[model samples]
Target: MNARQPCRERRQRRYREQCKIDFEIRLLKLSILRGHEKMTRATEDIIDSSRE
Candidate 1:
């Protein structure tokens, strides 16, 4: 029973860590996508201004 308790705890801890890592990765990806969108918009504005 003692051995099982340790194993279960370890598994739960690992699962929590993995979840945290996944969440962080998703947040980073979202930020990167937003940056790309902003850059694209800025480029478009510059081109339009040049044409005018």
Candidate 2:
């Protein structure tokens, strides 16, 4: 039981680090998608204004 404690702790720490990395990746993807949407909207607005 004593020897298993350290192993379990290490595994938990590794899992926590992986979760942090995944969260950051998701945030980056979301921001990129938002930026893409904003660019498309801006382009549409320009095209609409030109037609007027």
Best by TM-score: 2
Separate clash counts for every candidate: 0, 0
For candidate 1, the clash count comes to 0
Whole-model lDDT, candidate 1? 0.69
lDDT of 1 by residue, 1-52 (tens): 7769999999999999997976676566556767877546665455446434
List lDDT for all candidates, in order: 0.69, 0.70
Segments in model 1 whose C-alpha atoms lie over 4 Å from true places: 38-52
Deviation from native of the Cα of residue 32 in model 2, angstroms: 0.4
TM-score of every candidate: 0.65, 0.68
Inter-residue clash pairs, candidate 2: none
* Model 2 per-residue lDDT tens digits across residues 1-52: 6989999999999999997976676566556767877545665455446434
